[model samples]
Target: MKVRFYFITITLACLVLTACNPQTNQIEKTQAPQVIEWEYQIAYQRGMEAVTWSLPAVSMICMRNASFNLGGGYNTVYWLSEIPTAKQEALTANNQTPYANVYLNTKNGPVVLDIPPASNKTALFGSAVDIWQEPIADIGPAGADAGKGGKYVFLPPDYDGSEIEGCINVPSGSYQVFVALRCIPIGGATFKEAAEYAKNINAYSLAEINNPPQGNYIDIAGKHLPTLPDYDFSYFGYIKELMDTEPLQKRDMVMGGMLASIGIEKDKPFIPNDKVKSALTKAIADGYNYLEYMFETPGFSLIKQWEGRQWMNIREPSNDGFVFDEGEYLLMDERGSLFHWATFFPRHLGKATAYLNAMQDADGNLLKGEKQYKLTVPAEVPARDFWSVIVYSKKTKAWIYNDLGRVGLSSYDKENMKLNDDGSVDIFFSETAPEGMESNWIPTNGEDFFLLFRFYGPQESYFDKSFVLPDVQLLK
Candidate 1:
């Protein structure tokens, strides 16, 4: 019995040793010792953050050109061409001059106006044809006469002085208007000609301000304006330019940083060399590959659509060439002190308009005999540029009638605007007309119209919400 017990004990000892002792084969299997699951986690987080930081710089550059005088916004509309020609005509009959029409939507309706090269100012053509030209209107909307006290009219491009005063119905919603002259490619027109062209076709239509609907004016005192975040955004433009120049490097840094931030560490060393250099190289390469995979992912290829009216684009990092992305990437740090538009366009119109829907107010009721809604811009309104709350016709997609020959206001025109002691500005919207009020009125013509608030060089006040625009309200 003693001998049998001893044999059993010896067998148990051997088993124990095999389980606890390290083996050469086991160690060899893990040649890349520096790599571990946790290391990957860190790398991922860092890469994502890097991408977030770098994205908005592009938007800032785009925003500089987006201002009130120009009706600049993330998704502000631009007219590409206005060469009036018949569709059935042969190729030779079509005018290829690339004449364009810039448009803005106000409470009155969509304003479809065009500007041609003015023979007077050759020197101001480039800047004038920009969104910022003075004396902006030559001929106002043909639908201005179609006023039914509360109905909007449509105005086609070929709207000759016929009885076809384009007008339509108004839907219930909060709205604002943007007055945009046109877009001339970076070097498309001569500076003087563009400037003079802008001067000629200017102003929001308020021609109906006097006739019927009793009070004659639409109150917009509660209307709000769209604005950008406040930051030292000037530097952001330069950063975007640099990123465009060194695409690959920016990509590498972003990917690498993301991985690092996520706690991904270099765990395993290369074969036979448990050196730090090998491990580090592998770590970076892995991050790059992961980033590449993300770009090609199926979800990244599609564009984000907004409200059936606008189409937002997205950029694929791997796609070469001057390909433009449709969506804007937003970044707000934990404290909300930092706001970033990290996309090619600062405020992409389609997406921005979609976003605007969320904050829109419920407009007041409009009786058939009612004329207009009176509104006032809050004193603390946040924006770097001058602002004008114009009206747009939902049916005809054109601006309403005006006497000031103005559709919107700008910072440069501050002296010309009437302001409250608190710095707030007054604006009017109506289908008929406002008694005694002429210059600061936006005609809505009773149809549904959209509004846009443009900021030129926004300051910190705009982002912090210290300057809040009023909601659109009906005057009793």
Candidate 2:
């Protein structure tokens, strides 16, 4: 499994220490070592590394391609006029609120994102990310504008900070940018009503900021949108496209160089030969399985939210935004595992929202479909907006398909859901309702699943760990 680079590293280290001869007491002129022959194992190990490196970028590409498929493109705005359903298959997508999304291409020049301020009826909550899924700016009240609304200019790598006036200027390293936001119903307004009010937000070329064309808008609510990355030789195609399209980051020079060994290069047309194709196909599968193993690993110190409970936060609460950038080296696995189950990395936490995950039950067993489980939420929740417990299939990281067409339960369903004598709520997960608990049930549909506890507008207790959420307990 040793690649040519591995041998080079070893050989260089040996030369530095052992190349000095005792007889001469001097450093000898070293002869160049032969490069190791390439093989499937070499490509396999490198491909796995590439998957970890490329997951974030590839996921962004998947959504951007979906944007084009939905009759939208760079600068064309699309939104879910209603809450998302299973039909919208992006990773761990929220089913609670309406979503508005737009992709921007800054290859030619800068792009302008015009966000409307928090009004009487509607306010937006979300972030804009570069193609790497790195947060560029946060939107809405808790964001860059602080709810007053401002024009955000996405400047390209080549653009200087000159003559750009009266707007938030965001300098982006990658050429492509994705902006996604949720429409929050405000001042007693309804969710759907707020979606209509969100039409005021728009993105266009900075060249036409003065006379921007009437914005393009499409409602992708009921569409069967597929935004998951492929795990085959085709995955390399995404790498090739980015190589041809965007600038190679300084940090990624090593991975970019390794990609060349497997037939992906910017200067050359991406036509993989039989040998490269065979190596890549197997590499992707192995890479994905390794990532799956990382995701399923329990009690990893970073993801554990509550010390005593199985509830986990993908980004360690103290580490905001999951950058994993330690200045010495990028914690690739931390970033990879986080994006493995979710998309749309947020800029901040505990102010607008907080997400905690649980794949195992109280006894430390993986959540299963054939089994029944129940989680009890305390009477006092820290979310000012709302709290929801969502279930997604472990295989797809997407919503499960059940006859009831339900994915999760939220505080919004409190009236229909039965509560304990103490006012705490019991939400069940099984093939069917737990006797009279039909209103509180989230169906598993015979598929192994995981849970996402979302606290929207989470209060201080959530951050201070005073409001501890309980684990899902197995039912007899």
Candidate 3:
């Protein structure tokens, strides 16, 4: 009876110790690995999309900042006498047009942009974008002014004034504005002439227009502009800066909440815990890979430009000004993919310009510089202003450098090129030009490259799919 009592007592004591001991309780609490909360996971995903979608705008701001740092400072227009060839470090830049840019900060009040009348052979276009890179308004030839010289007043978002006559009112969503102007020198006018025309463009505050500061132009022809951010944990820093810089629009509220959940709220220091930091780093990398996959795959909502051809348009033809039926909350993947493909360009659609890119030849093989290929442009290439075909490095997305300084062939220079017997033009891509066909050859210098076919002021044929661009045919 004593042994039984002792054994029973011992068992009871063990049970109580095991159940009530602090160490045991602590061990039980940590027995299973910590699982991330569902809410946290959802927040992470939304944050990833927010970052990806905002990357294009942030990248443009970074580019403008880089330019300001390199070519004088803000409010000073940087003019590029030479077109952006592959040597230029801009993001997916075209090599056919000379450009000038000025960064505007209208935190105090309105700023005035004085656009000069373009010469007869020059077509100039200017667009003012907020810090988020959203297009506020377009000036110059294709813009509201219709190439006539005028003063464009960039008003703040909270402005409550009556409309000013004579001056075009541009309401900016953010105080920081980027004004990029493209000057196309046509009809034998040189880039020097284009630079001269760009120099005449000026920017000043409406309050100081009477005694405005002299316009400053810094030539950035061969200078390198570092615009791409390091694809790592530091990218979040850029996102934070962008969030703080741009005013929160209604469309950004959801994203802002997501960001706040991750400790990236505006006006607050972003300090993610180790677990969240790890998750975010992985998420960013995954997002980039996903975007690259979208670029390679066929289902990015890409529009088929030509039948039996590899050329594809990145954005849908029917998208209203790059906005879908959902307005700002449109398809995230499609919009993110478009921005990833080309970072710093307005979504002007087919009106201002139509863009088509070809990565592979008609045989569906990746384009290589060691091989020769030909693209035959049918006569009357349906561009109201002009058209150009530029070769860009697949890896860099910049102009492909070669022995020939030419990175693009434009219709403006068609008289200097050799045409096919049928009035169509055959442009060749190869490391070596054929005998007497040098003018038609665009040297690739043994590098993998892609082609960007641009139609400025595209006609109805391009939109109707009637102006089909020929496939790139590989030649021995």
Candidate with top TM-score is 2
Instruction: Provide the lDDT at 92 for model 1.
Output: 13
lDDT tens digits, residue span 338-358, model 2? 788887777656677788888
- Error of model 2, residue 436, in angstroms: 2.0
True-structure RMSD for candidate 2: 10.0
lDDT of 1 by residue, 434-465 (tens): 67665556555455554444443355664444
Higher-TM-score candidate of 1 and 3: 3
RMSD per model, one decimal: 22.9, 10.0, 7.1
Order of the predicted models by lDDT, top scorer first? 2, 3, 1
Measured with C-alpha atoms, the lDDT of residue 340 in candidate 2 is: 82
Instruction: Go through the candidates in order and give the clash count of each.
Output: 127, 0, 0
Q: In model 3, what is the error at residue 49, expressed in angstroms?
A: 1.6
Give Cα distance to truth, residue 379, candidate 1, Å: 3.4
Candidate numbers, best TM-score first, in rank order: 2, 3, 1
Candidate 3 Cα deviation (angstroms), residue 279? 2.7
- Evaluated at residue 105, the lDDT of candidate 1 is 34
Off by over 4 Å in 1: 1-371, 401-406, 411-414
